[model samples]
Target chain A: MTDPPDRRPGGRTARVRAQVLDAVRAELAEGGHEGLTVEGVATRAGVHRTTVYRRWRDVGGLLADLISAAGEIDWQPPDTGSLRGDLTALNEEILESLTVRPSFAVALMAASFHSEQAARAQTRLWEDRYAQCEVVVARAAGRGELPPGDTDARGLLIAATAPLYHASVLMRADPDPRLPARAAAAAVLAAAAGAFSAGGGTA
Target chain B: MTDPPDRRPGGRTARVRAQVLDAVRAELAEGGHEGLTVEGVATRAGVHRTTVYRRWRDVGGLLADLISAAGEIDWQPPDTGSLRGDLTALNEEILESLTVRPSFAVALMAASFHSEQAARAQTRLWEDRYAQCEVVVARAAGRGELPPGDTDARGLLIAATAPLYHASVLMRADPDPRLPARAAAAAVLAAAAGAFSAGGGTA
Candidate 1:
């Protein structure tokens, strides 16, 4: 089947999608999920309501598309020659993203809680983000810095992020400047002790 | 000022408070935060709206009281003599609570995201829960199961719960049957290595 020109990468269709998604973010920031509307996003994005409805159908659909689009962004894992450095850098990046737009982060999480589709999107988002960490672990193993066997990268990554999320999201505590380093240190310490390896404690 | 008989613990006032809070949970489970109504809750509790309003004032007020009431319930730490056993018991408790009423858990979390009052309540809830874990750590340290001197009970408790929360809450993944054991093992392994002591990696 021949591809439509507007549907190609970086085409008009893609631009419209990006514009609409950006508008959705703005709406969420201004009024939260409850106040967001298809009409509002359409107007903010300078797109027709019909188009928004045709593409997204509703707020849940828009959220799913927004999450998927966010996952599509290019993300590269840090390679600082050591497992500790790379993990620290990764955590710092997460800390920055979360702290930079905490309300947005909270809104996204809140949306995921109420809607099944949004929850699925969040799962996909986490899976994709975890893939980046896997690469970092793979590189560390290649450099002989990590154990040369099957490793549970998921446990290490979750351990690194969970404390930060607990403090930031659940507790609503002010961001601790040392949290990134502490998280990375803990994860590295645990991983070094084989806690995150296959059949290990964290496994 | 002396306390009135009705205002004392296990009295009529306390009974009313418990009834109202229980109704609130039922409302949240059935309709979520958006659909929860003060009138509905009052009716469900077989109390007048005036009584609910006099006590709670509004839904936010009800949520705050509900969260506090939940915290006030007797929650003793499992004194299993071993840090590993205690942590496993704690995680098991969390697993049972979350799994038994998944919708209620999600509703509570979602409410915290939108309302500052709810967020504060959630923070208080965590603080209260962590206190129970702190006692477990203190007892373990006394028994020489954990390191001497000051320990970071918060880190160990958070580490034990974070992965489970990440999987069950954020990713909406089904609760892993082995998660309680794995979480305890990881925390115990790390804590044994001083990762949860003063000046440890997680500190």
Candidate 2:
């Protein structure tokens, strides 16, 4: 039988990988993804160049890993007993994640734009996030809080959050404190009116 | 009097500038905005390098002018009688513009992200676009087609289009042909429900 690679939680390899990722975050925080380099990350992590190259391959590889790691965080989905409450909770979480760590968020966005691999990772992350949102909607439907039809959960979620993304990401505007709640309310009202139903909304 | 910079329609200066901008659009269409160069624009436009440099200053300057020139086009705002029709018309225009000349659209978007000067131009463009949308809502309200008390036209418009931008721009996904109509209906329903009214929603 072939030998297994290190799978221990606190092994040397895990520690090294953690250090490298931390360095990558630091570099992204210092600037944007404009001029990030593997050598720079390696130097910042205090790891050898060859080690960094052999492991990460390039900046795109590092960014893809970073995105995948972000998906791996043990983030709990919102379950606040109502669609409005659940949606508000989800939007607040997104707002906090995007604003509290601006550099990381911007870097992740830039990588998604600049690299195909990172874009795939971003799509996967979005799919996972949408799945969580679906649970909230499905539960609401079960409770008769929703209209008696198949509401497009993913569409509602995107509609709820897209304005926030436009303001912060494209227009470079400051995040409005009331935006998350407003966005959630808008989506909820529309959904309750059957605007998100497959046969109703897309006029 | 100091010599007047050629302000005459179809004057030598105007023609040269048009040629340069045409070349810029062609180049952007061919290769995107990643490595667009002034010299390349000059050569393609059959203009001298010094003339291009003196007039446009740099790529950012060229892009700024390009954006301003775009604003100068004879693009009419949506004039449909109903808010839903008007918003759908607006979104159709946006979708068509973004998809029809992808290189030009991507370059403009990239310029908005890459340069502060271009960002200002982009903001102005948005303001202009929003003002046009405001007219559609104002007219609807005037005709008693809308429920009253400050409908937040800009907010509604952002809600209507942000999903389309998310689908086409950030996510790198195929353009969803049904998105524009869906977005318009969602915004109209939300607006009618008073979700976009400052005092009505965000509860």
Candidate 3:
């Protein structure tokens, strides 16, 4: 530990970890990326710098934990047996991820610029998210909810949410429930079906 | 304005301006929005501080000029008989914008954080681009390329390009011509048609 091991017999380790994360988030909010430092985090958390370093190999690791802990929506697309229902549920989940923790959101995005670890973490987060969509998509395809030969459906599904969520996160825009996702969903399915019918099923 | 206010000055003025813009873009490429500043840009351009400030009132103005001047797409959507041709044209333009001027791309995105001026500028740019699509849309509508009451077709046309464009810019990803635009165009139109035709052109 930089100061000394904060083996405070009065408190549990989990609580201390939470405190450290809270400090990191607060620092990020106050100073953008420039504010966060291991020593500063230690001082705020009342933990040793060595303790923080020990727990996380570096700054990125510590930030990664914070982001991972921030809150991810469970992969649960509604099975209303329609494409509309599936898309609505998916969009709601994306909105939740974007809205739940604003500071963590900004920090992760900014950190993604400077840290390979953050970029990888961000990429994995997206992969996990897109995988969730694929389940509902496959089900929709089987049920004929999606048009045949509409293999491009999933890409549109994500294109729907990515921009709206990105606008909220990066631009700090007032969340518009209907812009990117709803529009993409409405349009994507339309074009896919038209193209599919035009091509004939076998084509 | 930097070297001199000589509007009819020799090619030297043009070269100096190019050098400065190159420096700004380089800075943005290396470090995102946070690295852009008069001091940093001046250092990179090998120009005096007064020059940058004199030509452009602030970073926002300089950034705006860069966006309007260099980022202008070569062509807008033309009066094509099919919606597909117009949308393809528009999306291709967006992809071209993203690939070439990545620095200004990030700047356009980051500027949204600082002021409504940026938002207005961004919105105007989108609207201007959308106007280009509007012509093809109106032609298509008159020709029965779409149903009678297609409310979100404009939104759909944009969905093919905007979200994907926003993502590639923010995530620093290579712009893929085929998947994001072509797939999205196909899918979005399908979804839009489904939503509308199922509703008897009410959607």
Candidate 4:
């Protein structure tokens, strides 16, 4: 088959980009945003300082690029047979990413708070992730798992996932082994009660 | 009536502490964590730099003390006669704090990510806030609004409030006017269905 025009070539440029990004993650994990220097990344990546300066310009640029790189990954929402199972799997993935020692995910989130470019990039990545995950809701609706009428898929999805972020990232709470499934089950029950229906009210 | 022994005196120390913390909030709102400094805060508070240095010692100290000061505020959760109404009021308060121009709440959260002292102080403040809000659940249970068994009040509260933070702080989504009430309604429904009951499962 002919090579796809949009496919990235496995060339030296790709290799350098991968190396530099890896170095960025390592430096961020070790020293956080305050200590992430372009020079440090260059030294770690074995690239010339001038090359790093010319390509990435500053720490903000490197951070923005790192987030953009994350969006290129071929990630998919879980395909568990039930809505609750799917949500549980999704939450498990989120928990694992947040709980890993010196987590690149947590470091990147902290770095975003310190950099405007990174914040904007992080927002884009979040929107993209939400959009991707909306498929889970759509599948549930098709399977007759959701309540009647138009469900606010985005609202349901956010409700399902936000607790994990709130607990792990904001509160720095010790992980409760049962929390992922418990939160998912709560969201599923709420959704099934038409709580997430468009134009739904507290009445 | 006599003054309580534990009550803080309205003395020079109290006045200075208030002014310095006010300056810290203003500085954080204007310039974020990167620009907050002891000298700048002292200048703004009209206090000597040495005094600030002696008291706070560093930016981390300033951040931690600022958070501690927040805990001293005489704030109370809303008692709106129903779980959904109370939760809606709580969410509105949170939304206002997160969305105000040059939001001090957002700035403090960002600063917490950058400083270990701030992070610990923030965690304490969060735990305190959650503990204070538990009364909302207790009131709901007393009114026969909750299910028949023990409820996981923390889980329920987190579900009700996490969507706002996930939206405004994490994804930077534009404020949805109805979200506060809607999220509360969803959480209330889940709680009524025993989704937040102790030892609950997806089954």
Candidate 5:
């Protein structure tokens, strides 16, 4: 039997989903997680309550869909053939997310505190982001950009920036927010590069 | 007619005060900020209710003294003659605290969240700690350890590590429990060193 064609949106359903999701994000940014309710969201979107409920089983479901879109933010690592350019790009992506969609991040983190499901969801999204960096690290290792055989350097690498991103959004302090991200990316890359050189030389 | 000499610790008043303060900390840590109670603390210390109440005034006063003592985890920036050494020391302090006096940090943060007085106290403590770091940075800068004149780098620095401390003790995910503190310090120091070098050339 032939596989069915993709049932991706082309019309009103697509438009409504876009509109509702946008409304939800705006509400989250403006009012935080507590402010997200079907009635409030429906009112904001100019959509019916039934339509909102029909689309999202609950607030959690709505958020999951919203978060699912986080994956769309660029996940590909840069190939500058040097750690500096590659890391700079990585930091920029993280900085962009922090500056633009910080509230969503804050809401998700706060929610993750209380909800195991939210934590699981956040973990997946973050791991995917880290996976992008891992690819870079792997390539950098091969290119003598990291300490030899530090296969799980991604954890340490991500650890470096995780605090910066978190503090920026929560404490409302970024201090050359751009500088922090860029510096973080650059430093990790350089350290890896140095490590790789040393390791390879020893080997 | 002279200032009274510093009393020896074996004195009745000093001994009693120490007992009350220890009781307060123990009780607070056992639960959280909300746990501190004059009656409970007095009972825990095996002290008379009137004596405890008269000394601390209220739970708030008792908590204040306890925090002031606990918060004084003095940091003398290591002068290992390199930024990396300074950062490692800082990160190690963070890690050691999480392991040794975990409850102290948790109680302080929780108190800040729960009470306005505690919040003000916590902020003061932070302001002081940040000032201490500033002195360390200045020393590094004077010795030409940091980039020349990267003066506006404090916010990112604090942002980078504050959340790591906040998360492990506050929101608390179990994956790589030590990562928040270690990562925050490493990331910030690494990034800061790199950023400084970019402007003034890495030393």
Candidate 6:
């Protein structure tokens, strides 16, 4: 079967998709979710409005595609020698993404709250990222850094990283230089104590 | 001096404000941020559009006032005998708020991302809640549950509660019933190890 014109990679379809998604990010960063509109994005992308309407449908579709595009980036979890180091490196990367000016990450997050399509796409991206990071726990266990038995990598990772989001996104607090390491250290201590051991009721 | 009519408690101004803010929450819960509009809120509140316009000016203004009203609520941190218990209680409350159907808390949080005024109001509310929760850490220190030093109550609290928000909000994961106590236990263990001590760089 022949591939559709829009489905061909490195073709005009791919170019339009890239242009539209870039415009979506630009609009979100500059004006936030409130100002993002199909017409505005189409104008910014130098694409026809009817083309955007037909392909993307609305702002929700644009947001969903933007999040899906993020998933396509070649990203990997930090692989420092120790779990503590790895988690800290991971956190630093997160901090950088969240704190960058006109942060595309933050804009995407805000967009997710406003769009069901975006929210579902974000959830898939998060699940994929967490699955990828499980190797960090596996490596730590192999090195005997964690207690014997299965550790809840999901729980551990959440504990290690949630503070950054809480402080920056929810509380809107000024970024503290030491927080990434401190939070990672705390999670490490807790994990070593088996707080995140699977099926364990509590520490 | 006599209070201005609008400034008097229990007067028409206060009633209108209450009605309008309640309407805002209802609209946000039902329609998310996209469905929120000054006209919708005013109509839902049974107030004249001019009255809402004169007072709230826009959807952002309505959202800000709604968040400010949340701060007016008389609330206290749980005083369970142990720090772990107290934190668990706090986490449970947080979980309930986040997981409730048509959750006003979640809606308000989503609204904050779209409006600068609402964001500032949410930041203030978070600061106040954190300040109130400091007593939990203080009580723990008094009982020798925490290390002998200035504990970073804010940091500890963030760690304990962040997992719930991360799982439920960001990941869109199903609520884990044991998470509140499990997370509290992890934070307690970390705190006892001096991970949260203000001057301690890392555990």
Best by DockQ: 4
Question: If you assessed candidate 6 against the hidden native complex, which CAPRI class would it receive?
Answer: medium
- Mind giving the per-residue lDDT tens digits that candidate 5 earns over B1-203? 23355577657677777788888877866865565788999998878899887877887677667766655756565666644456556655655565555357556654553444655665666666666766656666677755555643454345345435543543353435544444444444444445434442122
Per-residue C-alpha lDDT of model 4 across residues A123-179, encoded as one tens digit per residue: 999989989999999999999998768989889999999999999999999987788
Chain B only: TM-score of model 2: 0.91
- lDDT by residue (tens digit), candidate 2, A64-109: 8888888888877799998888888888877777778645766687
Instruction: Score every model by TM-score.
Output: 0.91, 0.91, 0.74, 0.94, 0.59, 0.92
How large is the interface RMSD of candidate 1?
A: 1.8
RMSD of 3: 5.2
DockQ score of candidate 2?
A: 0.66
Fill in the DockQ of model 1.
0.60
Per-candidate clashes come to: 0, 0, 20, 0, 4, 0
User: Which structure is stronger by DockQ: 3 or 6?
Assistant: 6
lDDT of 6 by residue, B151-193 (tens): 9988898988998888887787898989999999999888877
Query: Which scores higher on TM-score, 1 or 4?
Result: 4
Better of 5 and 6 by DockQ: 6
Candidate 1 displacement at residue A135 in angstroms = 1.4
Of 3 and 5, the candidate ranking higher by DockQ: 3
Q: Who wins the TM-score comparison?
A: 4
**B-chain TM-score, candidate 1:** 0.87
Candidate 2: where are CA atoms >4 Å away? Answer: A1-10, B1-10
- Candidate 1 C-alpha lDDT tens digits along B124-191: 88888887678888888888987676878887788778877777777677888888888788777777
CA lDDT, candidate 6, residue A149: 95
Error of 3 at A93 (Å): 3.3
The DockQ of each candidate is 0.60, 0.66, 0.36, 0.74, 0.16, 0.71
Best by lDDT: 4
